[model samples]
Target: MVVIKNKCISVSYSDPNFVIVVVAAAAVLLSLCVVPVSAAAAKQELKLRFGRNGEFKILQVADMHYANGKTTPCKDVLPSQVHGCSDLNTTAFLHRIISAEKPHLIVFTGDNIVGLDATDAAKSLNAAFAPATASNIPWVAVLGNHDQESTLSREGIMKHIATLKNSLSQVNPLGAHAIDGFGNYDLEIGGVKGTRFENKSVLNLYFLDSGDYSTVPSIPGYGWIKPSQQFWFERSSAKHRREYMSKPEAQKGPAPGLAYFHIPLPEFASFESTNFTGVRQEGISSASVNSGFFTTLVAAGDVKAVFTGHDHINDFCGELTGIQLCYAGGFGYHAYGKAGWKRRARVVEATLEKTEKGSWGAVKSIKTWKRLDDGHLTAVDGQVLWSKKSSGNRRKKQIPIT
Candidate 1:
């Protein structure tokens, strides 16, 4: 007989069930041991909130194009530096920028690896994102055209990214929405802690997978954001808006939103050199078919800016109908770039409004600037994308590129 006393399993010498009870008790103990490990993982989830100084900074690193670790040769680098330049140069730049800016969030806005050159997609992705992971900062990513030319499909790539340390990138949003793309998700930045609006989502970030090649024979360029993806976005945006407005302690209007994707929309071609801040060296490489994603954004009336990457050399920010469209210049040495032009990344800073009682409130202004990978890590073309004080008039704060 097996006797249970004070949570102890006492087995008799003659009992045939002794071994079975012992095995069952071992299984129960093993399951109890697993609970703390699962709880630890749950506790590791990142929560983004404003600092005491009321600022949240985001660093946009785009088109890394990393491949095969240190073996891949760099393109379009100066002749003097070409002897040893490789993907490691890109990694070094990431480390340098992260050190200099110390951003709250790092966004890898796609083409993270050149899939064709990557013999092992997982290894390349690990090296490509090592900086963000090592820094212990929250990071997220979208996908680009060339990311699935290797061992993994687009869905596989997103799933791999979602497993990396400090990665906030999701395979897709949960629920029965049936979104069209892989990395279609959003992250909310909460207000200052200990404030009345601490739990409130003050800033919203939308990430979409602007897909690879066109499926339709007639529409020739890159793939556009699908209708279902747009529908998901609209629903998500509306939900955020409703939550913000319903709160008693919420500020006057809807919280500002920013979007990140891999490919530029067709509307990017509409900006002239005179209207935008940075240089557009290449043609707008948007999909042939205008998928009306820009129209969806404008209609939503919450997203203040959209950041994209596919055109490596075009690092410009232009406004159309109250929405700013911007590009994060190519950040990797493995990707094609101008020999003389320095690789760059974009930095966005959102400042919270100060209440009458001197505490932080909703987002007051959204500003952006570009940082070149030169020796100085030069900051250029600082501009205000949006401002509550301006009353819809976005003022340009230009810092000339030296």
Candidate 2:
């Protein structure tokens, strides 16, 4: 018999013992899994808000490339540390960063697992995300080129991810939008309590699936963000703008937006050494065909920055046409990295502005920096991405390169 679902096909032979062994393994795994949260419970718990100190911190974990749990060997590491290095080292780094940063939300910007190396996609995903699930912090993820090379399809991986504890990821948006890919959704961050904009969405977070390899023979590179996804994004952006404008504080202007995806866009190649901050050791591995998504982002007039994680070693943030494009650097020991360079993650903090009466108002500025997985968990390459005070000047600020 042949069975197919989520783009995965399996052929079953007539064997009673086969079913028994599969059932037994599933039972054991299910017993260990955390109970999935109810939709209403998840909605309430995931509603983001700035702290009393008027700050919302986000930790961006990129290219985890985890596989086979603790068994996967470390890549591109020093000889001294190569003895016992494995995927467990990646887990330890995640735990250390989460504990140190204590971010309100964690964003896994793809390559979460090395599907080819992972013996079981489901098991690998569970192990890869155990730190976030165990930490009980709200998190979201998008797909990468490597995540669907296992038994599970891209759709299957996203569906499983949505069911994980404290996960805000969705398979797709609700309604009949006919989106191009799975895991295209937006999250709103509400304003501070007791403020006039309290009920208003002060920030928007957009997630899109920049797909795997190119399907067309003529296009000999990565897949571009489809036109359908662009249309959906435009509609969503307009809807959020209308809602924000309904209130009197619309004069404060539209809420800032930040987008996350797995692959970098073609526009990433436009920056040179003198133009961008941080290091670009490798070439930009972008789609061969330009999809005009960057132009759409500029047209939307709200997205302040875009974050991606395909070219692991190129950890830079550059401004182009009023939007900041950034790479989160490599975070997993299993993924490719420099020999002596420590693994790192990016931290983004958005602070609310102070009102005339000395209370928190809308978001004043968005700043970001990276933390290395060294002894002190050192922070480096700090810079402001966007600020309402400098809204008029869209030129790139000259930050010293690290």
Candidate 3:
């Protein structure tokens, strides 16, 4: 800490016992140098903290509510007419997130199109993905309750996903993947340099689909993850973490691997949506609450942070057990929204950066961007909340209290 007042400038350091004052008549600055840890210390805990320098970027966009099949002769697409967001003013914002962030992976966390309308969620998804396609960035997407429960059928859903993939082909030859079973998909990111260290590293990302299971299948109103998919999800999620370990490039971290999903997990779910990890979280999910299915997945080892969207409200990121749950504020249908001078009802631009060494860091950022309002690509006010990393904290902590 530094203080300058009546007659002095003081400098203080938070070491075992250290508070020193350095006076500078000509203006002097003190820099705190964090000593690098020894290799042995590094091995004990992997240090992963938020840093500007990183190898790749993973951008998550939620609830675009594109009016796919409907024709909006004028401007607004009424929710009463389609019960979905109009994607108004969001296209440019989406493009801006891509253009400025240049993320390596993009995850659309469901509610992609206002599925209630005749407009195909697939076409709306295409429009939403236009910027990603243009940037040649790879992406993996999952569906929301609105997507599964909408007028579209199972076949319709499959067709919609396929349609989006087809359109993406024009941009990326590797194309897109719809994440089999539990909306669970994996990708690897490498070539990141450690901020403090000299070695380059990589990151493995997974999108866990804790599909909406609130509504009963018999009711025929919402998307359910289904038992079979839940079964496969458990088996496969574990498989991914094990597979991640084999990768020589995978950063040193927890084995569960990093994942993003729509809808909150059992532990994070509210009472009404609570199921521990069993049928509630897994029903269309798996009965995930206190059940074995949810336990087994978190136990996989490499699981670091789980970013999600479904609350359709604020951009929240909190720690659940060892895993971090990040909610990218509502990106669609802010019907009762007002931009608080800062535009609180806006989109969130999140990033997971890996330092020179193999440490992982997460950042929650807000942007009051208006290409039509303002032209620069900078994030609003230029401030963010970043996670702190120890000397070698690789986020390798095992999960599940049981």
Q: Best candidate, TM-score-wise?
A: 1
What TM-score, computed on C-alpha atoms, does each candidate reach? 0.87, 0.87, 0.56
**Residue by residue across 225-322, what tens digits does model 3's lDDT show?**
33333333444454444544454444344222456666655555532323121112122221333223345445654445555556544444444455
TM-score of structure candidate 3: 0.56
TM-score of 1: 0.87
After superposing candidate 1, which stretches have Cα over 4 Å from the reference? 1-45, 391-402
lDDT (C-alpha) at residue 266 in model 3? 50
Q: Please identify which of the two predictions, 1 or 2, would achieve the higher lDDT against the true structure.
A: 1
Cα lDDT tens digits for candidate 1, 257-282: 99999999999999888998789999
Candidate 1: residue 216 Cα off by (Å): 1.5
Predicted structure 1: lDDT:
0.83
RMSD to truth, every model: 13.9, 11.0, 20.0
lDDT: which candidate is best?
A: 1
Residue pairs with backbone atoms closer than 3 Å in model 1 (clashes): none
Score residue 47 of candidate 1 by CA lDDT.
Answer: 83
Native-referenced Cα lDDT, model 3: 0.41
